[model samples]
Target: MKIAVLVYGSPTASSAAATAYRYARAAIGLGHQITRVFFYGEGVHGASALAAPPQDEVNWGQRWQQLAQEHEIEMIVCIAAALRRGVLNQQEAQRHGKSAANLAAGFELSGLGQLADAALNSDRLITFGG
Candidate 1:
């Protein structure tokens, strides 16, 4: 099966991203394909390179990055949500007069079309959100 998980809450405040991560890892481990992981709302924060967690806490941002790298997951952040929250890509930062871009590696900034596409392509579109 091809699964698309949509995460729409904060990394620390909400466990949506963490739940999505576990679902993705488990699905892949069970011989399923993760078509895409869509980050929306505060879920975009998981892609921020500047996110710092306490030493004892799980660094979800880095964990997502590593999961993408290790499993070749297609991780995408909602551009509208990201832009509203000040998460920008290098090109977007330059165009919008921002000082920094922290969308980070392994995650792409994309529009709703990507989410729609993932929905169409996926065998199941599961959502994790508040």
Candidate 2:
């Protein structure tokens, strides 16, 4: 099955992202194909490069990056939502005169069309949010 996981919360504080991560892992373990992981709303913070958690804490950003890498998952963040929340890519940051762009390594800044496409192509679209 092709699964699209939608996350719309902060990485550290929000259980939505964490729950989506777990679902993705479980799905992958069950031999399911992940269509994509889409981030929106405050969830754009999940892609922030400036996030640095202490060694005692779990780095949700890094965890998501690793999940994407291991499972070959396509990580996508909504461009509008990201920009609204100050989550910029290198190009967007430069275009907006920002000092740095985080948006995570495995994540791509994308538009709503991507989500629409994923929804159409995916066998299931599961949303994780408050």
Each prediction's whole-model lDDT (CA):
0.88, 0.88
Per residue, candidate 2 scores C-alpha lDDT tens digits across 1-130 of: 9999899877766688788888998999999999799998888898888888888987777888998998888999999999988999999999999998877788999998988998999999999884
Q: In candidate 2, which residue ranges exceed 4 Å CA deviation?
A: none
Return the clash pairs for model 2, or none.
Answer: 49-102
lDDT of 1 at 29: 92
| Per-model TM values vs. the true structure | 0.95, 0.94
Worst-scoring 10-residue span by lDDT in model 1: 63-72
Error of 1 at 121 (Å): 0.8
lDDT of 2: 0.88
How far out, in Å, is residue 118 in model 2?
A: 1.0
